[model samples]
Target chain A: MRTSKKYIVTGLFLILLIILLSCELMLGSVYIPAQNVFSVLTNNEHQNEVWNTIILQSRLPRALGAIIAGASLSVSGLLMQVLFRNPLASPYILGISSGAGLGVALITLGSVGIGFTFVPNGLSLVASAMLGALLVFSIVFFISLKVKDVMTLLIAGVLIGSIANAVVNIIQLHASALAVKTFVLWTLASLDQLEMTDIKLLYIICPLTLIGSFLLSKQLNALLMGEKYARSVGVNILLSRILIILFSGILAASITAFCGPIGFIGIMVPHIVRIIFRTNHHKLLILFSVLIGSCTLLAADLMAHYFITSVSLPINAITALIGIPVILWLLLGKKDISKTI
Target chain B: MHTILEIKNIDVSYKQQKVLENGSLTLKESTLTALLGRNGSGKSTLLNTISGFLKPTKGEILVSGVNIYKSNPATRARLISYLESTPLSPQNISVKELVAFGRYPYLDLFTSLSESDLTIIHSALFQCGLSQFSDRFFNELSDGEKQKVFIARAIAQNTPLIILDEPTSHLDFIARREIINLLKTLCLKENKTIFFSSHEPELCVELADRFVVTANHTFSEVNKTEVLKTLINS
Candidate 1:
């Protein structure tokens, strides 16, 4: 009976994702017709050049970016929650997003003080963000070797994140008006600015890492019982821990490098999936998180773009608006939220 | 009777402080051995060392003539199943699903649970009197029922020797008796060599076939009457 329920929910999410993706493509600022959107997507041609460009250039890449970012962040959150055995653990809990932000801040905000006035290109921005994320993650990994307690590692990550944010704020204080504006806008996070090349890079990284996480479902399930029980059942705890960290780190770093730290979705989507599916089994959780995560961000992005007449809200604002209430409801409900972890 | 377990003169330590020094014991096949010790008497340390969770500073442990420390984790898992005093209470896992974790050592990465595995899981649940509660969530069960579910998981592992640390702690008098009785039945019916540590010697006195007492950092086998006296006097 549970297996059939899983199938039905999975099928429903797939259809929901398709509908959301279509709405994202069709109901944008200019409001292209459904048939015109379909023709533009299929034949790469439309009678109206403006609508064609809107569909192919702006809407298409943004839609794909939302899907990849949503799926990557949600899966990363799920891995962190299981790895740390804490429900509040999200992809950004380890400070990788803060590291990425620090990197972007240094390039965009710090460069002003050093008399470099040029706008940083996309490639350089990605490289610096990735470098910062890896640097922080490597430090956490090193500390994990000596600590032997996951709670300590979690505290260390929080402290490291605070230190990185402090440095970013100091740089922001001295930056020029233009540079500070650029840094602030990046922190707000927008899915609409990703180029096709950026989307392609995300396609390569996120799917491979997500597949790797899926293959580790059995180990994750065993670990839910605790490390000792997992080891007794023949799981190599060290190897599994390293692999989980590496996979979640890469996913978070790649998305943050491109999308400027899209928040709330990473922490919120897994809880929603767990509540709906009513199982902690990662095999089912990972698959459904990917689908539902995609649908959620697509819907959020559609609202961010079309909610007002002509003004697009920041993606982060919309996600937090959606995320906070669900989390509040889960906490206030009859079921204890801590038990879910 | 064939000897199923052998512990040579092993020394165990916690944080560089020796807890047990030069300890040795042996167990026969299809027998239930109760470990009786006072608080902080190194009973848990000894059990952990035997279950391969801790490395002895100087000694060797053999299960059925093979050195356990020399084998891989999967091989050790096939040799023995261990239950800690307080296993984690994970949410949203059913009783049957938790028991199926026993087959993990036998499975490769790509293979799902086979028919034989399912049969073993069902039999384990039935033996533990948890068949009707198989669909219940782990946290929803009472302490006694949860202990049985954990034992059912250990039984489903299908190992020759099983080790448990304080299996009957924090239970009512009736639940304690029931757990001991269940352990005794598993030994007689399944022919498993069972070694468990417990604080309640009175509950185990009627059912335990053998008793080993941990006192003064060493292990000694004592008779039924002497074991109770030793525990009370300690």
Candidate 2:
């Protein structure tokens, strides 16, 4: 009976995902008919070359971007919450995005655009962003080892993020006007402008990291049991901590590297999954989180693409617009927020 | 072997402040022992040191003749299971799932429960009278049931030695008696060595086969907790 219910929910989610995907394809700036979307998807000989270009080049990547980036961010959020044992914990609060943003700022700010080198410019961003994120993560990870207090470690992470943001602000000031515009535009592009190559990298990195997180589910659950309690049950605290941090870092960094630092999806999607599923089994949470995340971003992208014909709403704006109210309601509700954190 | 756990003149300190100084004891097999101490008397420190969670400044603790501090976490876990006196109850976990986590030390980084693991978990729940409550959320359970779940988790761990700090401290007398009864049953049936700390000396005298007490930074093995009570007042 339980299995049947799960199947029904999964089926419903799958249908929603497909409809949103189709809508995403049909509702871009240059609207294509729903039938054209079907032919284009099936690779039938559609004579409309413009429809073909928009679907294959722009809309296709954006839709795929929504699926992967959304799933990655959401899973990252769940992992962060499990790791920190804090309901409010997410990649945004931990500032992995800020650190990656700082890296992007450094590269885009000046003449040494390594993208001009043998490595693809997009690939360069990935490396720099990953590097910056790993650096900050290492700092936080070390602080976690040294400082036993959770509040202290969280405060230290916030302080590190502030420092990174400070550097980014200085870079914004020093860079040329074009550099500033590039950075600004990059920040605006969440799950858009993802080159096929970057998408391929994401296919490899995201699933690998996500799988790593799933494999660590048992350890993650142990962590929720309280560190001391977890250890008594034979959890390798150090190993689990390192793996959680690494997985979260890689997931968040890749998303930021490819699609500018998108906000709130990472924080929002997991809460939605938990609310919907009413369970915290990591395996189930991870699976549902992925599906719901994909559907949400696809829906959000559809809205962003079709919200205003003249101007496209950025994905970040759409997510925040959706996220803030949910957050406020959660706060206003009698959820005993302290117990969760 | 008569001795299941041996602590050899161990010293524990935090921030260079000594908590337990020159503590030594031998825990016999299949016996229920209670560690009695005042607040800041280092009952927790001593238990932690024995469990290999805390590194002592000096000396060794051996379980089944193997130096626990020298042993790896996995090796130590195989020999002994531990429980903290006060733990933040985790949410969204079922009693069964929480008990299944006891198999953690045996499984890989990404653990998969085997048939044997499942059987062990069931037996643990059965022993704790929690088989019916397997699907119940941990936080929703009563305090007494929650403590049993902790013990059941440790029981499923299947170690010869179990050390708990203050398992019955906050519980009512009935709950306290229940926990002691449960521990006594575990000792008799499983032939396990159970060492638990408690503030209530009278309760310890009623249930424990042996008593270890802490006073003025020293841990001394006492034949009876009442004798130690008299010594403390003196």
Candidate 3:
């Protein structure tokens, strides 16, 4: 509905959303016109069978993929922001996604052809990613316990990320061309190949995870006042933090498992939500972030596909292109905001 | 009245650097004590140790006659509250939401906010002049308003003792006076023992019931007469 600024923002977001869905349905290796796209989307079964197959088997799932990855990554981003209490904190900066990647490498690339039969399979790869994310989460968490400092935890997360990157690089060195190619392709990142099964998986998981995130609204609200205040209020600081981190890790790992470490959406969208709404109320911020994140990723996905021919530009590349400007805008804006500390 | 917090022979250090050596302080029920010190003094450390955020090298902190360090953090939090040097960064939180955090100890994990919790939150907001700002985002509030929001949170916490680390550093002249007045009123009206560290000796000498002068790694009590003498002599 056309409406006021808030609804307008929502409408613009939805408009962008409709365009993105259409782009996803219409553009690919084969270009289906807008009409044909709509026809197939509706119940007109007489559309070109091949184009219809591509639309049903490929485009719809891929569009749904973008939506899920976007929502999941953004929620994790919001969690990182609250957890660290730093506006700049995000899933990518904290290296949570990279941790997931390392898990994938270890389980898939790292364990390939090795003698340890217990390294597990596809399920284990997901488990490994979750485990990897949990490992970093725990390390950061434990260090937080010892350090009692937010900045130290941020620095430690960076170090953890760098270490994970180094390990990933080492594994990449020994990987087979096929395995390495798979990893690289996944790393280049795209939502193009998402199957209906993956979409269903995300649809089921993301809503539950997001609800859990929203349920922590009061806890997160308390955290913004500082940890001590939260403790004073009877929030078991460790338990609340652990819950937030675990929730963040699950969302990050789940998205990374399917989307191959999509970037910048997790890093930038939350801030945009905060800036636009100018509120730290977690209930509003959480929902706004989810919508903006989904829209932003879908828009980015559409651009990644249509902007070039033959080879799709990585979705990460598209996000960085958009995300960096926002970062610079925030940096410029910081001078005016007076961020003491 | 039973002692709500006991600091006995505390020796806290940052690695090799000793911050507090054999430092000790006792907080009794229904007492407001000012922790006065220079910048590098260990006032913050002492407060943190009492609140179970840090460990003393060779001492014990007893809350309600129980060693606070021996108790788990959650139980200890319910007994004593510590505010840090600066208020935590504001996420998009409202005054009402911030105050509700004080009810956390009473509420189960993931439990819905209860009627009693709402009563506490409302009273806290009303007590701190934050009722009008209940739905306003924390960041949108001025520094003075934010400080009040935190005080409201502590009030809602309903703890017997509240420890604050420099609650008025960023406020202007009028705001500082208002906050100090508010805190003193809380002590008298609620019988909540307030312990806070401040560099402002004149403010302490004027406002506090009893002031603890922490300097040169030692502490001493300054009674009302001694407080004036200390203020003039220093």
Q: Which candidate has the top score in DockQ?
A: 1
- Candidate 3's TM-score reads 0.78
lDDT of 2 by residue, B160-190 (tens): 9999889986888899999998999999999
Q: lDDT of model 2 at residue B221?
A: 81
Fnat, model 3, is 0.58
Question: Fraction of true contacts reproduced, model 1?
Answer: 0.63
The DockQ-based CAPRI class assigned to model 1 is medium
Task: For model 1, report the TM-score of its A chain.
Answer: 0.96
Candidates' chain A TM-scores: 0.96, 0.88, 0.84
lDDT of 1 by residue, A3-95 (tens): 888888788889988988899888967888888888888876436988878887889999999999999999999999999998889998889
Best by lDDT: 1
Provide the interface RMSD of candidate 1 in angstroms, 1 decimal place.
0.9
lDDT string for model 2 (A1-341, tens) is 15578789989999999999988888867889998888987899945999988888888888888899889989998888877777878875667778877877888884434344122276677677777777777787788777765567778888998999998987677667777877776676566667677777789989999889888887777777678877776677777777777788788877887787878888778877766555667878889989998998888888887868677788888888887787667656636654542
What tens digits encode model 3's per-residue C-alpha lDDT throughout A285-334?
78888888888888888888777867778888999997789767875775
For residue B139, give model 1's deviation from the true position in Å.
Answer: 1.4
In order of DockQ, best first, we have: 1, 2, 3
